[model samples]
Target: MHSTIFSLLVLKVSSGSAMKLRSRFQPEAVGSYRRLLCSLAASTHSVEESSMKSTITKKSIKSEILRSKSPTRSPIAVLQDWIKSGHKVTISELRFISLQLQKSKRYHHALEIMKWMEAQKGFQISSADHATRIELILKVQGLTEAEEYFSQIRGTANQKAASLPLLHGYVKERAVEKAESLMMKLNELGLLVSPHPFNEMMKLYMATSQYDKVPAVIMQMKQNRIPTNILSFNLWMNACGEVSGVAAVEAIYREIMNNGNVEVGWSTLCTLANVYVKAGLVEKAVLVLKNAEKKLNTSKHLGYFFLITMYVSINNKEGVIRVWEACKSVSGRMTCGNYMCMLSCLVKLGDLVEAEKVFVEWESNCKNYDVRVSNVLLAAYVRNGLMEKAEAFHVYVLEKGGCPNYKTWEILMEGWVRSQDMEKAIDAMKKSFAMMKGCHWRPSEAILMSIVEYYEKHGNFQHANHLIRMIHHFGLASLPLYKVLLRMHINAQRPAFNILKMMVKDKIEMNGETSACFSSLCKRESARE
Candidate 1:
């Protein structure tokens, strides 16, 4: 009977195609049909042979999808190509591909896969699939489209599951009014059984600086007879510290200890320690952190990161060193993030000697050459006015295969500007601009003004004009840029009319200094005529 049922499900999955099954059953089964197929794939010899063939096909499809350099390539096109090549495309394989893309932060590709699945003739998208699609939409298309998609699924089974991601999107965006309306609706629909929704509300409140509302959210959770989890208590404790004081936060911690409903972990202890530190209770904070250390899960690096950071907050150098050594003693090799955290903490304490030691250790053991890790040390060097060391390290990083990101160039540009190496600074600025293309990074106004001042001081008309054009390209044109440009053009005996026209086009109101520069330019041009 089981064999017959499995065969029927497998047939349904294959769409009754006589073509050879070229896709292996994914280990994680999403629905009943896939689950039955997975179990049967493991039992029989003929099934095992088919599964092996399927594994190769799945690998081929995944490799093809991931190998495409263009993010805009259609996943549906890839799927169709596989189908044309005699490879059977299963829903589970599509889901697995979508999940892999999501894990790679390729939201556009993942959404394309979700859209392809939706267009399939016979396949039914479940409520859970709708929820996943809503989240992908939120990521790729933004909140408005996600809300529109949510509205279309209303009054259906997908509505309830789909509402959670929409609520989360509102919370993430800090849309207080919309979030409250959705929470009330969820409550009315009796979908507020778990503490997850309440926790989200509390998180939103905390983010908006309305700490007083956090406890109210916790109360609502209790009133609904929902059990508070570790995260709920953690947020509640943080809110208490903000609204009330250390006394109130400690009271919440005591209640958690006595209630025994939620399992207390290192995170809760870390929160309590943080409150204690903020209240200037250093000794108490240290005691709590020691206990947190006792409960710390050594397998996870985040716990050690928190401990090291808290120790740095207290200026407990000994404690920092202890935690660093403990993290190193863990079984697996330390991650790049772990090394970055340690280097950051050491640098914060102004212990460059130890920071250099940790940086060297990271370079020796790191599998991937992450410039961010090198950036921590580079920033420390630049901060200390060690220009020689900073320049040397920058060259060494390039030689060692470290690609300088925007932050790296920004740091070097600042240092060069400080040291009055205008040529080097300008070169660094251009590199930083190139790296910032397709991203949202912008040079700080202070840095831009410094470069503008450099041009004005030297009367470099050509470069100043070029720099202003670059600034305009970045949508960062301002009165200062126009003022400098007018001064340079007037000094160069060029027509200042175009500069004045640009000012008008940019809608920059002429201030006192700008009017003076404009008047000077007009007088110069009049005399030249």
Candidate 2:
């Protein structure tokens, strides 16, 4: 069926302009194709692949793990492998694969997939599909780069597709003004940008702690005649809860229930339960949680997941296991999001043993070896000050040909720095920078400060100066950096006048305090020299 649902597109040049026609595939054909992909994915993986751990030979274990783990394979690498092999690849297959990578948060590979698709023949992109590609750009290149990309939309892309997702990106970053501007554009274009973006705007307000502004967004939605869903109420309740406390949240819940304009979903019930718990109404909270669980629609995998996390919030282990096992029985295979929620719940409860078990199960079943899952456990270990465990897992990941992302390295270094293990902290810091080579990863301010502080605390001014020099070489200048370098020259009793000249060359203005300090320090250094 996958082989049968080929999307055929014919590109035409009219008036020396390229025109795109949407590829058509029947609903039944798409359903069949999805089924085929599922079956193929299931068949390619064996249930007992890693189960025979101790009994397997070293060579066999390496072979099996390399084939199954694939933790380091980029999306482009997958395509390149196919292309180099001269394997026939369909546009639909590439599209599906790109979507999978995107969902997995492998944006680098996903973008490469889209670029590859763009260059291929008969790869038609509709406005709808193009919307997703724009989101891919936002994820891969970040907000500033994505803005540049949106500014330069060409070809058959319905520009609105790019703009709408950019609005969502702005909301994600809590850029209220940008979100408002983009929303206005959507309204002007009459593009029918769905309620999801509005909901996101409310979320942004909540994140920024602008609780008072939330109601204004809701009022705007109503004035525009956009229907508000239960989630809108849930976020609205969160805002009300934050500002006016439990009493306000309770009153709002009652008002919403009595008004009857919106359907009271299970999430609404959970919100009430949360507020009840906050109010110390344990019996009422329990009753509402029971009602929420009772309202679970078994067909939807998300409801069960929500219930599990809710139970976790209440620290009800029995309820968590109950919902988890039941969901697994029905959903067949657990998604990474589900596992992320479950693992995070366990971590929040401080049940490291249970978290480790879930992580093992996740690793055994996970495709692409998503490092995020490992990072979750790493975060827990680092949070608990269990640096040994974190280092063990970090080494294990590297040995398996997997690279830890920037956050992973930061966590490890932060832990080492906390323990005042400067050697290990520097090692971790170097590894983080090493991993960033030819990648978009940037050194975070916190990590940079930790290294700088450690070096300064130990009177290693020369090393700190070298670090600042590297930062300047990267075209990044911080205000306090010049002061540190100046101090370093004085400490080393070196040619302080040369550093003063370098500062002048870099156009760092000398305030009175800086000038006096530099003049005094340079005289002392010259005397010592």
The candidate maximizing TM-score is 1
lDDT scores in order: 0.77, 0.65
Please give the RMSD to the true structure for each candidate, in Å.
12.3, 13.9
TM-score to true structure, per model: 0.83, 0.57
At residue 338, candidate 2 shows an lDDT of 82
Backbone N/Cα/C clashes per model: 3, 0
Clashes of 2: 0
C-alpha lDDT of candidate 2 relative to the true structure = 0.65
- What candidate 1 gets wrong by more than 4 Å, as runs, is 1-69, 77-88, 119-121, 154-157
